[model samples]
Target: MEGKNSQLQQRKDDALPRGTGNLCQWYVDQAENATLRDVEGNSWIDFAGGIAVLNTGHRHPRIVQAITDQLAKFTHTAFQVTPYESYVALAERINKRVPIAGKAKTAFFTTGAEAVENAVKVARAATRRHGIITFGNAFHGRTFMTMAMTGKVAPYKRDFGPMPASVFHARYPNGVTGISTDDALASLHDIFTQDIAPQDVAAIVLEPVQGEGGFHIAPPDFLQRLRALADQHGILLIADEVQSGFARTGKLFAMEHFAVKPDLITMAKSLAGGMPLSAVSGRAEIMDAPGPGGLGGTYAGNPLSIAAAHAVLDVIDEEQLCERALQLGAQLTELLHSARTTYAAITDVRALGSMVAVEFADAQTATQLQQQAMQRGLLLLTCGPQGNVIRFLYPLTIPDAQFRQALDILGSLLNQPRS
Candidate 1:
């Protein structure tokens, strides 16, 4: 059966258009903890963690059991037609847990892109404005509007032309580039003064930690000032936590580090232990601005996905994964830093919790490092505008021994002289 599947995959790739990229070998048989096995019987320690979707590790027993229990009871009810308790209970739990101060409400969706899109819809409905502001190097999604919001061009926005309008990009405060919080604010002011008026802007959408554009941590002061500015202009502040939420960043949500209260928060990736689930949670008043019938889909909150999400939350709390993330992150960061002394090519080493990264001097070097690591039975992902950053999203549930082994392998590789 495995042989047949391999042949089928090869045939599919040959027959279909190759616009979408493929990763790793052709066949993946099984995965557990922080390792994946290809059909060829090679095992590779997974550092990418499905781009931060396996914070609790691959196929966590609790999450699996939850899915099994829900599978036995009936899968889809189309929430609008027949609501389920799991969905309501999960929503209630998220409402109570998301790091907002006052009353908050949540709406579930199928993907991170959907969550982001819905957040914008809710913001526009609440503020009755037509413009949205985002940061340069931001990657929201692939949809028309999100592509317009995204700042990167080569791959994501290259062939996709005539994107939605009224979405403007601002410079994020990047200390490495000498752009300060005040500079970011000034960029916003320039946007309002030279481009779009503040009164016409509905919301300012930003990632607490920029994911695809490189692991750039947004300064706390920048987020605070954006919050204040949004309030002053009666505009919504949307925190896109799709990549940094669910304990991937020590806290339940990355915005917690800044103590900024955004009007909307979009989350996904690790929310449901690998299930296709996402959510837009925020201020009750603003979320309620959208008409009752305006916010729903056929598979918005699948019962099976909701059950898995509940178990995910339970595991996070019960296992104290957030604390574990912090410790593991520190260990990895130290290891990377120690190796950097030998590898002068490593320019930056940064992380929050287990969401860590090391940027190389250029895309060629980063790609070479990734290939070298994969050849050594470790899988790593390269992300950044220039593809120079190697980000680590190992599962929080990875065994200490396995993590240490992976770290040793990485150190050995990075310590090698540039070829």
Candidate 2:
């Protein structure tokens, strides 16, 4: 007799492509803040937070009600066609909130990739240049243009022939990997000298704190220098906040931690509290460079997602999630540091608020820890070029008791001998 999970796994294997990988084999039945229940009634602590898409947590009440209310009125009128008030209103809110100099404007999209690709378009239009520069290990998106911008090669760019041209990668400062800030700046200069001249580059895009490539925080000085370089070369600076936005990093956006401002910012994932909504917010002048009809999609600003995003903003403010993220992050960081004494394989532990990650000596050790944690009903996600980094994306809204319990599970697992 096959169990429910086994039966569903078999069906999934038959129906889904091999490329659509799943971290957990069990099918989810229901989910709440920081927890997921499988079809077999087994519950797991959700540390992955749906790949940083659930910063407000699963099915937040306010977000749910907002989506439901919008569903009552209408679903999609297509902003490019009918143009709803909610769409403009959401854009206005994001424009007001995003970190950009002078006046800012925001345009909505359905995915982070769409926002990123459109940002590139805006940059090119504004600067009248074609080339884009991104840092190594950054994960922009899977779309053709974004794939070209993305730093990682393996599975993301694998088997996909001929990425769009005019995109280049620079070395991102990673202390663990022994790449210093000077090395990164030198690499960028080398790119300008060897591949594309600074005048030909339209934008330099990067994650304030990298997500998929590894949880490496871009140093403050590095960002400042990049800002200076962009100004000197007339290149636009873009911060991809897809995985670091919505109070996950103790700030609404990771760029807030830096003193220098970017010309544009790309955001998604937690913007709608689990609903699919992405936006590109930037300087009003730069954004307006793209003439009418140059940007937009059939489902650009879905009404339900707009409503949920509005609710998400309210929830973040009312709940004081930013401060809570700092508190929880400090706790988790302390716990990981304590575990370091016992676990020799623990290499590095770095964090910016709750966006935390632990690196192991090898990919096998990281995988072993993730599997052992999963067996104990705790979900974890791994990243990095070597697949040796375990990132913690737990919701800031998680209850204290549940968060502590998850930490306990991790501590116990760390105490056990390596598999």
In lDDT terms, which candidate is top? 2
Residue-wise lDDT of candidate 2 within 1-419, one digit each (tens)?
88999999999999999999988899999999999999999999999999999988999999999999999999998888888899889888888889898999999999999999999999999999999999999999999999999998998999999999999999999999899889999999999999999999999999999999889999999999999999998999999999999999999999999899999999999999888889999999999999999999988889999999999999999999999999999999998998888898999999999999999999999998899999999999999999999999998899999999999999998875442
- List the candidates' TM-scores in order: 0.97, 0.99
Candidate 1 regions off by >4 Å?
1-9
What lDDT would each prediction earn against the true structure? 0.90, 0.94
Q: Weakest 10 consecutive residues, lDDT, candidate 1?
A: 19-28
Tens digits of per-residue lDDT for model 1, 161-247: 688889999999876568899999999999999999999999999998999988899988888888889889998999999999999
Instruction: Let me know the TM-score candidate 1 reaches against the reference structure.
Output: 0.97
